[model samples]
Target chain A: AQTVTQSQPEMSVQEAETVTLSCTYDTSESNYYLFWYKQPPSRQMILVIRQEAYKQQNATENRFSVNFQKAAKSFSLKISDSQLGDTAMYFCALGGGSNYKLTFGKGTLLTVNP
Target chain B: DAGVTQSPTHLIKTRGQHVTLRCSPISGHKSVSWYQQVLGQGPQFIFQYYEKEERGRGNFPDRFSARQFPNYSSELNVNALLLGDSALYLCASSPRASSYNEQFFGPGTRLTVL
Candidate 1:
């Protein structure tokens, strides 16, 4: 079974600053996919970014990027130029080509202060 | 194109009761997955269906079941609900069963089991 861990329960960053949310997972599969999801107060789940384990190059989407270290089983999300709208519950998830289900971390609540 | 859509944005039920939640995946998407997100926690995979067939299921008991139709719409059913079952039920869909594909999510149905 794959388990994702988000060590930080909560994180705070000032507007226009940068913040990183750490994530680690336990999986035996070498080829897999990782993702970051944001859930706002409205309870809508939004996709932030995604990374393929086979690709060494990290995934970047606008202000969001991931530092994916396959050997360390660590996939961290970095939010640059943080805005108030970025404040939400962020989750890290794992899935592979053979599996359709996604295993998610406990989540980190990020607060972007103005 | 419309994103995933879920019905009964909010629902309340008592223990030992049954509840059904519906989900309509984004147009052209052929896979639908269900997840449960408890308060202050990450979403947990419940079930996944592709091509109208059961693809994967989580550790949840038989109390949780789901089905997908030809149109790609899905439904989650919970029987003998318990208080611990209270959570936000999310529906996500991808173009196919490919793990590398990104999933789009719906706003979710907040189920309160009292």
Candidate 2:
């Protein structure tokens, strides 16, 4: 069974600043994938980033990036130059292999204040 | 191309009642996945279908079932609903069944059980 854990329940950051949301996961499968998804009040789940367990390099998308430490079973998302629009509930998920199901963490509510 | 779309943005049901949510995947995408997200928590995988075949099933009970159509659109049905079943049902679509494929999500359908 795969389990994901996000220790932080809530966090805050100022606009134009940076914030990192922590995530840790334990999985039996050697080949797995990690993901960060953001859900806004609109109730839409948006993909923020994804990282493959086999890859040593972190994944990045525009202002969003991940600090993926496979050895530590950690995958944290960093949003640089945070904007008000970035405020949302962020989730960490683990999947891959033949499991076909993604396990997600409880999530962290991130607020970007002006 | 249009993203994944779901019908009936919201619904209200009672115990013993049945409900069905619909979803249309992105053009050319053949995989559809369902999730249940309770308030203040992350989404839980329910099922995954690829090319109109059941690819995976989660820990959810038999009351929760889903199927994909020839066009790759899908429907999630929950029978004998319970208050614990009240949640946001999310639909995600990807081009392939592999986890390597990026899954695009839709605005979820909020189910309220009274």
Candidate 3:
């Protein structure tokens, strides 16, 4: 079974600054995918970024990027130039080639202070 | 294009009662997945359907059942609901069964069991 863990329960960052949310997963499959999802006050889950395990290059989506360490089984999300709009509950997820089911971390409540 | 959509934004049910949640996948999407997000916890996979067929299921009890319609829409039925069943039910959709595809999510239906 695959499990994702987000050690930080909560995080805060000043506006215009940067923050990195850590995530790690336990999976025996060498071929998998990692994802970061954000849920705002509206309670809508939105995909932030995704990384393919086979791709050695990290995934970047504007200000959002992932530092995927396949050997370490770590996939952390970094939000640069954070804004108030970025404040939300962030969840880390893992999925392997054989399954479409996503295993998610506990989530980290992020707050961006102006 | 509109993303995934869920009906009955909120629902209240008594213990031992039954409830049903509905999800409409994004246009042209062939896969729909269900997840349960407890308070202060990440979403857990419940089921996945593709092309009106069950592709996967989570560790949930038999009381939890779901089906996909011909239109690719889905319904989740939970019989003999318990307090533990109270959570936000999220519906996600992807273009296909590939694990690398990013899923689009709905706002979620908040289920409260009293």
lDDT of 2 by residue, A1-114 (tens): 889999999999999999999999998898988999888888678888988888898899999999998889889999999999999999999889886777889999999999
For model 2, the docking class works out as: medium
Off by over 4 Å in 1: none
Candidate 3 per-residue lDDT, tens place, B2-113, comes to 8899999999999999999999999999999999999999999999999988899899999999999999999999999999999999999998965578888999999999
What tens-digit string does per-residue lDDT give for candidate 1 at B1-114? Answer: 888999999999999999999999999999999999898888899999999999988889999999999899999999999999999999999999755778889999999988
lDDT of 2 by residue, B41-106 (tens): 898999999999999999999999999999999999999999999999999999999666668899
Candidate whose DockQ is highest: 3
Clashing pairs in 2: none
Q: Compared to the true structure, candidate 3 yields what TM-score?
A: 0.98
What DockQ number belongs to candidate 3? 0.81
Candidate 3: residue B40 lDDT (0-100): 95
TM-score of each: 0.97, 0.97, 0.98
- State which candidate has the highest TM-score: 3
lDDT of candidate model 2 versus the reference: 0.92
The true-structure Cα RMSD of candidate 1 reads 1.0
